[model samples]
Target: MSNPKTKFSVLMSIYYKETPEFFNKAMQSIWDNQTLKPDEIILVKDGPLTAKLDEVISIWQEKIPNILKVIALKSNLGLGDALNIGLKECSFNLVARMDTDDISMPDRFKKQIEIFKEKDIDICSSWAREFDGDETNIVSYKKVPKFHKNIIKFSKSRNPLNHPATMYKKEVVKNAGGYKKMLWFEDYYLWARMIINGAKFYNIQEPLVDMRAGFSQLKRRKGLKYALYELRFQKELLEIGFINIFEFIRNVTIRFIVRILPKNMVKCIYKLLRK
Candidate 1:
């Protein structure tokens, strides 16, 4: 393995609702266990956090006070804005995104960085294994396309890349116009924009993170409001020239049908849809 001297930053955003215990677990996975340690971690506090959350941050700060850079916002700015703010403050050219509640594998960063060197990659992500209370008992695995061409083509029907498991160049994302405050589809919006702008996408075939999925994941996908969010995202994509009118109508219709279906049915469909 060839190790380069280049350093990268971990850009993450956290809000008040997340628990302290989960935060600690995620930190350990992202920081403690990485074969290639992050030089800097830029954490954005979306808003005022609870005392428990503060306590968790304190513990991590105590461990690596100098490396942890906290960007505190006065009020909740949502994930997209919080991340966009954090992105600018990152000290490195390359930044890896970490969700506050997920556990990345020990060799995740190492493998991703190695690919960045051996390939002309602008963005890199990996498959993720979904788990309930534990990582050992995986519920499912999510896979995305591995090459830029396939990724662009796949964007027509679903998200081309996994957001939480993704790492990309700071300049590339910035040039692509960064993230938008689009309801629940912020990451998808950014990916669509980036793909249209000719960004190189690569997905490591390995499962890089143990994603948290259970009742909460299912619950979030139900309801009419969520369906409206899907429609809203498709409309924006149409406006941005990412999709033609024919593709837009077809996608929205399909998504709306899935949205109204029974949760269990939708779950089965999701599994079948993702490769």
Candidate 2:
């Protein structure tokens, strides 16, 4: 059983481009489907949402009342900034990050809360299963190391945590500078800082959420622009002393090639690599 006293908040940001149907499903998972519901849900409107999106949100708001806190932005602030704003409104120390298009398993929050109760970690995230069009069609699993040492080492090369499935201590993240605008590498950069700051980490061995992914996600990872972003992000890692010169070169070289490869090749590589 989960501890009732260990209250947590679900922090989510939705922008105009997200599908209304997806957003509705996400809300159902966060509230209706959870075994252990959040004490509060901070939903950040990155910008003005479409009428359809607003309709879904409105229905949730009416259903949950005070538990659903909506923060509206005058214009789009992007995920990092939008989340930073939402963090300020969270009433609990533990905050779970949820993507607008993802589905949280019924036991996701319950299991995470149990881990927090038993462990001394500052952050905890579970493996996520990626599904293309629906939850039944799982494409891959995004798994991370289960302990702090392995997580630290893994951070030197790739992201050490699944951002959307993460539950982190609010003060620890804020002290580590919260989230920054690093294009596609925002979560990765934040993990680097947290690791450098000596924050403890842990990962559940099984998938706790279903992430929506497909070729569109892969497309965003390709192109010269994405390759440049990878280079810049890697350079930032070196500058911050999180990774040494050799690691920087190796990381950038491999990522650069992968980013510039044909989309079809990348897809094959992803399938081959992920379990």
Candidate 3:
């Protein structure tokens, strides 16, 4: 008998200027995982593809056969727009998110599929580790909140689920209106919408991917634009009753501590917790 729950599609949005080696590694990790091969892999190239990237993608297209679907965008649309395009093109009912620079564990899909079946969940995610160049460390080693109510509260300050480690029901995602083209923090915005619509969410308590850390465009910005975005989202949650006054204050306090702490101290604390 065919397993209904086994059908899944992995969506990855890529932009130009990414290292071809990292891109190859990310795709290879998905293909190498044996428990459940993705029925379709949607690769949305956000803008005009570079010669090297095109060659790298062409090789994978041939190697992976027709299961790999490549969509090249004529103009550069940000990550959020590219992801929306990929989501719309996904053929399977189960949609999993992947990053162009991350490495997934071999059993990542198998474990996520098992948990989705067992919990009958609409959205699922797992813990992840972080790497800075040659140095790697466990960033999170516990379960993220599962229930919609709890997840919303958790999202008031930090992103409750790792975007690259998430899988969701396509229908649920569509109903939530898919990814929004927010200036920054598209994933968090999508999660907020999903919770608003009462989607069931779960986080399997296991490390599933190695996410590259250090500075990115969003992290490099000055003037607290990202902080303002978080504050706006928190206000929205407050209006909807997801977080109370005390919880909001607590979340803000934690965010301040994280922002003010030195990088070495934060790493030290993370190491001590993992030990």
For each candidate, give its TM-score against the true structure.
Answer: 0.96, 0.97, 0.84
Q: Which TM-score value belongs to model 1?
A: 0.96
Off by over 4 Å in 3: 1-5, 135-143, 146-152, 214-223, 235-275
In angstroms, the error of model 1 at 154 is 0.5
lDDT of 1 by residue, 1-275 (tens): 85557799999999999978888999999888888889999999999999999988988899999999999999998999999999999999999999999999999888998899899989999998888777676767888888888888889888877788999999999999998899878889999888888889999988998888754586688778888988888988999999999999999888888878987888788767643
How much is 16 displaced in model 2, in angstroms? 0.2
List lDDT for all candidates, in order: 0.89, 0.92, 0.78
Weakest lDDT window of 10 consecutive positions for candidate 1: 214-223
Candidate 3 local lDDT, 1-275, one digit each (tens): 86765789999998887878889889888987555778899999999878888999999999988799999999999998999899999988888999998888889998888887788679999877776554254343534666667776677666789899999999998898888776657887788788878888888777788777533321443234555655666666577666778877876666546545666665565565433
Query: Which pairs clash in model 3?
Result: none
Judge candidate 2 at residue 37 and give its lDDT: 93
lDDT of 2 by residue, 51-114 (tens): 9999989999999998999999999989999999999999999999999999999999999999
Alpha-carbon RMSD of each model? 1.6, 1.4, 3.2
RMSD of 3: 3.2
Question: Which prediction has the highest lDDT against the true structure?
Answer: 2
The Cα error of candidate 1 at residue 142, in Å, is 0.7
* Residue 10 accuracy (lDDT) in model 3: 96
Residue 218 of candidate 2: its Cα lDDT?
Answer: 79
